[model samples]
Target: MIRAYRNHPYHGRSPLPQTVVAGWLGITQAQLSRVENGPPLVHLDRLTHWATLLKIPESQLWFSLPSRTPTNRTQQIAVDLLAGAPQGIGLSGGSPTTLKATAHEGGGTTDRRQFTALAALAGFGGNSLFDALMLADRKAEVVGMEHVRLASSLVERFRQADAALGADELCDVAMGVHTRLSTWAARSQYSPGLGEALQSALADLANQVAWLAIDGERRQQARPYLNDAITRARIADDPREEVRALACLSLLVREDHPSESLHCAEAALRASRGWATARLRTLLRLRTAHAYAQLNDVGGFDREMTKARHEFDHGPHEDDLPFLQFVTAQELTGIQGLSYLALGRPARAAESFRAISSGPRAGHRRNQVYYTVRLAEAEYRCGDIHSAAQTGLRALPEVRAISSGRTMRHFAQVKSRLDRERSASAREFVDAHGRAFQR
Candidate 1:
């Protein structure tokens, strides 16, 4: 793949505009062009932004390093990080397994030409995605399993707190705990078996922290931790955890990069095909269905929802990963409703939301606010201006209780929609409730 990129560097540029790319890479247009043309040599300062802009798997995949071929370990790490979804993602390599490269008029320009490859890439995979990372013959530390179990307990508590409290200062606290646990996992003296287990736990913890950052809209802060989680989960040979991390990333990017998001969600499903418990399958398929809805692929969305419903009905399997306890019927219902909402079927969307009979529990406060606000939006879209305004006001208390920026945004959207109507209820709701949140 590197050889192909070196010969025809046109495909290396991202789909974003060149001006955006130049500014993001902190370079002049000419410099950005040179970097793209790639005899693959780049200065130290430029490489970080370059690799980042390209969305390469690891920060150290500085592909443009002069004439030096990377060490075996470095190359393997790069491969390991990307192997989870090699074919689907449109990074520099395109498809590692069966990449086909054709030289265009030249190698320097961004060409849309196709490349054909001999084989599609596949690396080490299965339940433990990173089973190969541990050193053989190492001895376990006396306190390893005990430490891992304690960390798992703390992670479970952190998740519960996130659901109830929202992503407030609690997110920072989770980040701190994750950092300390990750360092502890890296310290020497554990046996290979113990190290493997510790890595899985640490990855799971880091994923929880990353998810908080994502939900809080601190996206740039969330990405590296996600990368770390993916790497560790793969090395730990825990494909279930790897799938979980990938699904989070998929959800994060669905709005901004819907196609890439679809690929990522599908990749998560592919990674888990043989090993994921039914609940895990349900989670990934739900995410996939959401991506399809965003892309307006009605067929794809319906297909995934059907699969999700089947998985949910047959789930709560013994093989389910304990960390993913949040996978519940309510969450599934909300996602299905959301997909309908995205498709512009307001009546259908409202009907889906009507399935929930009562206010959400403390842990589902965010959902309570989110779905309620969504129901109001759907009602407004369906021409029930008075009902929409009244519904919006009813959800205000839950919105304020959760401290979720997302729910607050929903309130604003409902107000904006209702402000279009001239009804007394709409005008009153907008003046009293909507105005309070808009400012």
Candidate 2:
């Protein structure tokens, strides 16, 4: 239980202290500490209040308990409700039983009460979804979404949170929602709003997928999803959405059509201006700089890269977007490093890449692979074949796990370059993992 409490780390980072938390619950700090250190003996009411105030999910809090013991009938009912439908069910499934129990307890089984219970379940589901995503355990993520759908009201809340949290944050909630809704939509024969919602979710998923693809050097497969994301964004009737799609597309296509990439990215920036949040605008500009580098427009790349760095440095806290709250400053620095590499500035690229390479491993695995690949390429360009080979070797495991053609292509490109030098280790790594490069 102490391990669980300490592992979250978010609690320590929260502005509230143990005393504040205890005071809020009308308990002494020592009691709270004991609760934190020992088995979860805190009342469900107290736990729920603590979770809400701490911005942690109650499900996670419950799950963190040393033993899966339920304190009361209500807690047991909640556990059954959570376990019976690992994926959520409609108001009918076990909801009435729970509601009746609540009413009997003098809690008045109103629709509002039911809705609140559902929301809490969904919030728990969201936390589970986030955990699965962080681990890159796609199978677990899929299961988590089933629960998210039970808390259907969260979908709208996620959407509303998007504006405040930015695209990255939106992508977090959107991922599980997208997967769930897509399955639901297919099963329900494409219901109204479902298609639009799925499209919105897919657009976000595609961006992450595309990022993964690019990281794994599977550019070809990445392109289709990027294009699909754009189409979905257009259908969703949000210019800001379209801008994000186009910006990502620009990154995938930049090498093929640098001028067109720049044009598209510029257009996205223009469209997003004054319409999207500052983070969105900054992301668009970063995409433009990448395109500029591909076009060998050094001046343009430098200016835009500088702008991206400045904006990123002055950016809002990650907590502003609950979904993307995990994204750190180092990730943005990696982007700038890639921009430098694209502009043919090997030294500057190396500096940026080193920063990313040395940073903590907390973000997405795909992101780690992406920056590491860029660093390897930069090392190769700077005539450090040994470093490049080493980096390539390190990145191979992550690359193999990804299912993107673009990422494979990037790997192939790097491998091909290194293969010419007959580096035995590099060749061995390639021979072992080359199967993943296939389209």
Best by TM-score: 1
Instruction: Give the lowest summed-lDDT range of ten residues in model 2.
Output: 94-103
C-alpha TM-score for every candidate:
0.63, 0.52
Q: What is the lDDT of residue 160 in candidate 2?
A: 33
List RMSD in Å for every model shown: 21.7, 16.7
lDDT of 2 by residue, 156-251 (tens): 444333322222222322333334434433454443433444455555555554544454344454555566567766776545446666776787
User: How far is 5's C-alpha from truth in model 2 (Å)?
Assistant: 46
Question: Please, what's the RMSD in Å of model 1?
Answer: 21.7
lDDT over C-alpha atoms for residue 386 of model 1:
79
lDDT by residue (1-439, candidate 1, tens digit) is: 3334334547455444555656765666655564554332211223434565555566355232322332333333322222211121121432132212222233411211110010111111221212322322223334244445545645665566566645643454456456545544556456664666667777787788778777665655566667878887878766656777899889878888888889999999888775566898899999999999999999999999999999989969643566557778878878888888888888888877666525355245566667888888888888888778888778766676665566666778888778778899988888877455555
